[model samples]
Target: METLKGKTAVVTGSSRSIGRGIAERLAARGALVAVHYATNATAAQDVVEAIGKAGGRAFAFGTELGHEGDAERFWAEFDVQRRAFSDDGDTGVDILVNNAAVALRDHFQDATVADFDRMVAVNIRAPFFIVQHALDRLRDGGRVINISSAVTRLGLPEVIAYGATKGALDSFSRILAKELGSRGITVNVVAPGYVDTDSNADWLRHDKDAWEETAAKSVFGRVGEPEDIGDAVAFLASDAGRWITGQHIDASGGTRM
Candidate 1:
């Protein structure tokens, strides 16, 4: 079950919520994890400490993946973290979980140029380059899991921009799977629907009746938890998923028709 033992993982935007959940899961499975945060060192450090307390190895890394120079900074920081922690260089990465993303509430007509640009930068640009940078470090039988959203298939109107970016990523992941399949590298997308994270839980409590009504639509009868998606991502990043590639699997409690 320790398919990820002695492996290295870089989980971006991992200081909180789903990213943090994914990082913790990977570490628990015996992988050394690099936790990347945009600006909150304290939160990232907290996550690192939590992982350590649970008998896992983890380190905090900072990067503003939404900006121009952030990508280079991310890799440079990662190299330092990896080398300092893995002196023998035998702990090179075999798993890359693209979990970092930005989301803003905006209607299509009201979304500004800056809004669109920023989302694209973090959601699309960052993952693209991060994967490129980590390619050399990834072993032949590596795994690349992109965190996508149900909005791509749901086509929610207010989330046009966000959904578009995820759609593009879905396309990118499929093509990448084809390109890297020969090298034993697998690329896949995991799309989750309406996960009950900190923010959503608060909002849902305020509208209990509405939330219940919405939950009734799904066969699962409840919103998703971070652990739900984390488990799915871990499965894909494991040897059990070696034959799966170039596919977008919905982890949505069967909500979409």
Candidate 2:
């Protein structure tokens, strides 16, 4: 069933990994997807082509986040692509997925001020302002899904800054849910634990023992996959998840449970 037949979705950092998975899944469900990327134009185009080959609609938009006027730049490019993609001249979006993020691995003492600021800019500030700038474009009864991390609950000293940013993101979702409730716009967070994406290939894929330890963290005895997180976001972006908002859905495979 094409539940999202006439809707439009915007997924940030969707060139590869989890964001790519989410964008593909949403497009598969018949949503006209705007695949947002930071720098990799080729990778972003690959995503758009893949979606088209799958009989889904998608377009790529590039705007580097974590810098001045990042949100504005993204929206400007998004407007252009959305207008071109929409057949009925409808520019309103039905789903907004804030999946773009930067992961910083550093213990508190080794974490530099610049590193902290960069993390904040990408993870927290970007999403905050993106939503702020998207209010007019987002239609009533829309969905806002923020991609968060399990480190917010699990004490991961190595990624303290990254975890802190997700913590703030969760708080942002809770508050935004209330503020947007009247418009029937549901806001929520999906926190994934130890997904095996390219970003973690160096440590998770290369070291067998290290991989086992990370896999053991989940009750399922396996590391999470990109589809695991993508499926969770797909549910929230659908009508079935209408009643679920102002909440955190842990797509962590029972990690730390």
Best by lDDT: 2
Cα lDDT, all candidates? 0.86, 0.94
Task: Give a tens-digit lDDT track for model 2, residues 33-108.
Answer: 9999999999999999999999999999999999999999999998888777665667788999999999989999
For candidate 1, lDDT tens digit of each residue in 203-257?
6757888688768757889877788888898898888999999999898888755
* Candidate 1 CA-lDDT value: 0.86
What ranges in model 1 sit over 4 Å off? Answer: 89-91
Report the C-alpha displacement of residue 220, candidate 2, in angstroms: 1.0
